[model samples]
Target: MSTVGLWVIGAGGHAKVVLEACRAAALPVAGVFDDDPAAAGRDLLGFSVAGAVPPPVRWRAERKRGILAVGSNRAREALATRLAGVDWATVVHPSAVVAPDVVLGPGVFVAPRVVINPGAVIGAHVILNTGAIVEHDCRIGDFTHVAPGSVLTGNVTLGRRVLFGAGAVAIPGVSVADDTVCGAGAVLTADVSSAGIVVGVPARAPR
Candidate 1:
């Protein structure tokens, strides 16, 4: 694999973690881009924040690859679409245990200590955050976030732009629909259908 540097798309806490994973994988970080004016020109992990995200033409011309480090699924997806044609890399931390047969799409970031079991298919720009456990045959759709310490049991199917919050657990074979947000530490015992917020034990939609 060639050693090409990347420009991380966020400069906040999530981006910090993603940068660590990138370093762990020995992928150089060229710089960072955040919309916040305060973050512009700041230094993160020895890499300078290079103002806002440049136009695709500018970054692509400079041979800058990118990975979305924003935590919001919708924002990540939107920026990814906007930056179409720019090169993106799939970054996995060395500490993570990814099964040989697990399929990962471009710009997917696997944080430290994540365990992805066999036959799992992680879609584009997904985040398998620190210590998350994805069990056998799981399918996570594009722009979804499996947050820190979350556990997905066997055959779980998560739809696009879903947010599985930190420490949450989905029981085996549960299917969560698109745009659903599972709250932190919530235990999902059944399938989630609607495209809104679900919280607490049993993980029902908010009334």
Candidate 2:
């Protein structure tokens, strides 16, 4: 925790946001990596691409904390699996308001202006995106993306890999299933027991 140098994985758009977060947190980045061969040797937001990602142990031994900045849930999970040996860092933007006791798992990204209330448990690699709000006592599952401007009311339970889309709203006490996609501007009013795409006000699968 003392050493602020990070080995950042991925060089895409998500990587850009995370790099900014690192800067805001005053965490110096040691290097940047990408799975795409074409991304190597290129520059990402003034940080030179340090070539393709090496095995976690290679970098971890250098005492730098790691972050998986890929956007896709599956890709992030796979990279995390590969980088299992890494000592992960939880990136919380300085502007985000998190309760003193909020439980944030390793590799979680709390973006700018995000509000996580008391008793919330954010799972590993979850993204609480810009301006999103998680009301008290919510439990967000691993790799879930609560997109910008979304709101999860108190006690909402999200399953793994759920995409709570931008500008969406989840009402209290609803349990969303794994791999569920709540479309932008949708309102989730009930439990989604089955994994699928839901949209429109009071979200449901399109008939």
Candidate 3:
């Protein structure tokens, strides 16, 4: 296979992790871009900051294959839509366990110890963080983040940009709505409406 030139879209901590994973996977990292102009010309893991370029400009240039490293699902989803014409790479860490029948979309990241079971469909720019468990037949929408140690039970449907906080758990067949945020250690047992932030056991909206 030809060498892949990787252009990361963020410069924060998550971008650092993704850069390291890209290096470990032997992909050539072309550079990184951040919205903060001060972050430009800085170095991240020996890769120099390549200046801030909007998704449209970057995609139009087509300099390198892109990866959405932003942690905010809404931002990621918007960027993914804007850059739909660009080639985005899916990244799976070597230690992630993805079943043969699992379908992963472009720019998805499966971190180490992540488990994606059979028939799971993960959309573009989604992040399955470390040790996250995605059970069979689950449909994870674009740019959703399944945080470290979180669990999504079988047949769950997660809407775009939904964030499950660290160690959160969702029951089987539940549907989490778009832009919803499930707080750390929350247990979700029912459907969540769009744009809601739910926390605690049974996942009620925050007071």
Candidate 4:
């Protein structure tokens, strides 16, 4: 296979993790682009910072391939939209358990320790953080963020840009609508329709 030059669009911890995932998958990273120009030329886990996103055409023209390294669901959605015309690469860590029948869309980031069970469909630009469990037959929408240690029980369906907080738990068969936010450690037991912040056991909408 021909080596592809991959460009990363962020320079935070998530970017570092994504870089490693790209390396594990044998994709050569051209460099990272961050908002802070001062960050340019700085080393991140052995990868140099290139510049910022909506990067200079010269950079994009050179690399040709890119990945959105953002972790925020909203930001990811926006950035994905901004770079819609660019070729973005999906990076899945070698340690992640993604079932053969699972479908992953472009620019999705499946971090180490992620478990994507059989029949699951993860949409474009989704972020499956470390140790996140996406149980069988679940459908995760575009630009969604399943934070570290969160668990989505079987058949759960999450809409676009849905944010599941760190360690949150979504019980089986629940469906969360687009733009919803589940707070950290919350336990979702029912379907969530309105786009709002939800927290606590049996997850309730925040006041």
Candidate 5:
């Protein structure tokens, strides 16, 4: 397959990180696209904001492959799902350590110093942020965000759209359901269901 040149869909801080990752991988980038009028013509890491992403027709016309660089899980999912025909780029920073047996779906973004161990299954559009450690056999669902410095112990499972916050730690074999958001610095000792936000040590859902 031909190496797809990246055309980033968002021009925010997250986009900058993706651009850097692409550079680290020695992948070429076409440019950036954002809906914000003010962001148009702006430069992200020396790459110009080409223009607003046109309709599917225009995207097809250009034949430009890209990736959703949006940080928000919902926004990334919406954009990626909407432009399903667009070829999405899976970006991984050079500093990240992904085991050979790990499975990463399309549109996944793995940031600097991230460590994904053997047998981990990372779904589409998942963000494994900087310094995060995903242990053996961890399962992260689509559009989930594993925030910076977080650690998921062996066999941990995270459902779709879940957000594991910065510095949070989940114990081995625990499962967090879809859309659950764990707060920064939280230490999860048990499973967290889809209901409510979780914070603090031994992370619990506050009533």
Candidate 6:
């Protein structure tokens, strides 16, 4: 890693947690940048939020490290892809229990007390929120957010841009398609092959 500190992109609630995780991991955070001009000069965890992010070329030339801290999967993916060549920083909270063989992709966030068992494959820019448990061999796709207290049993597969909501659980061997939204506290007992919101104890689209 470069001696220079990393920059956090976004100044929302999720950014707060990301900043804390970075601090807990002892990573120097340069500052936070948000597109919202109003966010500039506001205090975020004692750091000032800059009005604008550095240009993509500047990030490349300066070799700046950055992480996307937004909660929305689509927005996170957009911001990440836009900043081509920026060295994406992977952040894992100090308390996270990630297995030695877990394959974590660039810009992944493993939050406090999260457990990723061995052979799990986490894709780029994924967010494993606080206390989430990903059992062995689970495959998580890019920009997916396994929200706080969620659980994925062994061999569960999630597609890109999926939002496994807070406290949701997926039974073993289930697959969720891209862009699907698993509602908070929902349970997936089978496959979700469509992109839409699923809710209830055994999750299904509300129709």
RMSD of each: 1.6, 1.4, 2.1, 2.0, 1.6, 1.2
Candidate 4 local lDDT, 1-207, one digit each (tens): 343688888888888899888888888887688887888888998978866665446545664678889887788777776666777788889899999999999989999999999989999999999999999999999999999999999999999999999999999999999999999999999999889899999899876
Highest-scoring model, lDDT: 6
lDDT of each: 0.92, 0.91, 0.87, 0.88, 0.90, 0.93
Task: Locate the minimum summed-lDDT window of 10 residues in model 5.
Answer: 1-10
Backbone clash count for every predicted candidate, in the order shown: 0, 0, 0, 1, 0, 0
* lDDT head-to-head 4 vs 5, winner: 5
lDDT of 6 at 82: 83
What lDDT tens digits, residue by residue, belong to model 3 across residues 1-207? 443587888888899889878877877877788878998988899988888755666555655688888888878877777666777889888888999999999999888889999989999889999899999999999889999999999999999888889999999999989889999999999999677899999799977
Of candidates 4 and 1, the better by lDDT:
1
Q: Work out how many backbone clashes candidate 4 has.
A: 1
CA lDDT for candidate 4? 0.88
- TM-score for each predicted model, relative to the true structure: 0.95, 0.96, 0.92, 0.92, 0.95, 0.97
Give the lowest summed-lDDT range of ten residues in model 3.
53-62
Best by TM-score: 6
- Report the C-alpha displacement of residue 51, candidate 2, in angstroms: 1.3
Error of 3 at 32 (Å): 1.4
lDDT by residue for model 1 (56-105), tens: 99876788788999998999988998999878889999999999999999
For candidate 6, the TM-score is: 0.97
- As for candidate 2, its clashing pairs are none
**CA shift at 29, candidate 2, in angstroms?**
0.8
